[model samples]
Target: DVILKCDAYDGFTSNNSDENDNVGNPSLQYDIGINKCWKAVGPAHKQRYLEYTDEHISVKDDPIKTSVKGNNTSNAPKVEQTNNNHPSIVAGKQLSQIQTSLFQSLPFARYLNLITSLGQPLGHHSQTRRFRPGL
Candidate 1:
């Protein structure tokens, strides 16, 4: 079990309320019910278990190398030579047009609200927040 302390007032709100007085306040008692698992083991047993698991699993290759084609240079000339193919050009133009239309249809204010409400940082501030145990 853990207890967390936080500021009384909501940081995002601009309301002029008494921010310091949080004693017996109904708004401050927010409880999140998290189910946890506790295990009892010695340090040597834990180390042995970790080592056995590590030995059994195969090491993963770099994700980028696996996803991208290695023979890109050899394929480039052939792709360029087939530039006159009407189907590929038509497909590319259609895809671009669809992308532009989709982006244009999205509401800017709604997108901004969604991002802010989800605790995503704005501007040059860090995009990630350090997650604490009880946050």
Candidate 2:
């Protein structure tokens, strides 16, 4: 039996309309993957059942094979590959679709404001600097 576990974290914000936008701060997304298999023993002391766990494999490089916007192949010319990479292509398309949806639904302006605030000075006193009182 083989077992594998993977975890990932992601954060993002959009700068668009305030309505239907995620407020408070950038949202965090977490995902986990597990792969395993187990064998069951029957009441008679014999092996009866075999269970195979789901597995998720990730492709580090470009996964899309079709020329579509937001896809890995969006910028490359269509060419024939000597080997088949359909699984990767399908995964890439799904990932790209999810990212596109998230981006499209983000509130652009407020998100930009959050980013800008990070660089600005903090504290209430920072907003007011005492100039020459007599001037």
Candidate 3:
């Protein structure tokens, strides 16, 4: 529901009020979920977290090296050259979009951590992805 509400590009509003529900808070959900998987490996610790307090975020279309032609078996990699100056656009209810909206992280927030002082992981969200890799 939270992700759905945050459909506009770089637009999200938190309504943690007396009548609304803050339980769907994305940052809290993302962190505890990732940490659980991290601790499961014993050595794989989660060192990064989603920024929940941020109100707005700007996303840039940084070029990711993807094969211009799919299913390639060539020695040299061919990538599609594109103008990376454009704002990245996620259609609706996406993780990257939601994170940017809630946390106000820099475009493609690659270097961020959950700034909390909890002894252990908190609430968990069922869906997990490789948003954060290492501590």
Candidate 4:
């Protein structure tokens, strides 16, 4: 299990709440009952994550509201606003969107390519097609 350490008093605010659950009180601990086997659930979660990042990076067909798109693959997972605290829409997480662009544009592209090829050989991409960077 991963433990997130947050600022003492500030951690309890709604800004720091889990995206799925809006409860901000950090002291209160509860597990979200995702009733699915790990094998079935993990890939779906990973796909959603990949979709979120991809959509924000690709330039969308609009003027004022400049959004991004992925490779526009027909099977790409759709990003949903199921959570009020979704990182894509949250102020604190906006920097992550910028980071994604830099990750692709700068010298990191070679590393990303290498990592993708390595993961493919290990059958890591077998779980989810969303991991395909340009696809």
RMSD (Cα, Å) for all candidates, in order, is 23.8, 24.8, 15.9, 14.0
With a 3 Å backbone cut-off (N, CA, C), the pairs that clash in candidate 1 are: none
Residue 83's lDDT within candidate 4 is 36
Lowest-lDDT window of 10 residues in candidate 4?
A: 31-40
Candidates 1 and 3 compared by TM-score, better number: 1
Q: After superposition, how far is residue 134 of candidate 3 from its true place, in Å?
A: 18
TM-score between candidate 3 and the true structure: 0.19
Which residues of candidate 1, in runs, are more than 4 Å off?
A: 1-76, 81-85, 108-135
Off by over 4 Å in 2: 1-78, 81-85, 117-135
Each prediction's TM-score versus the true structure: 0.23, 0.22, 0.19, 0.21
**Residue lDDT tens for model 2, 1-98:** 01111111111223355345744444321110111111111232332322221232223232322332234444432222212233323333344454
Global lDDT for candidate 1? 0.24
lDDT of 3 by residue, 53-105 (tens): 11222112111212333443543223322232212212122554554464454
Residue by residue across 61-109, what tens digits does model 4's lDDT show? 3121132133334433332212324322342234444455554353565
Error of 2 at 5 (Å): 14
Q: List the residue pairs that clash in candidate 3.
A: 49-113, 51-103
Ranked candidates, highest TM-score first: 1, 2, 4, 3
- What C-alpha lDDT values do all the predictions have? 0.24, 0.27, 0.29, 0.29
Model 1 poorest 10 in a row by lDDT:
31-40
Please tell me which model should have the higher TM-score, number 2 or number 3. 2
RMSD of 2: 24.8
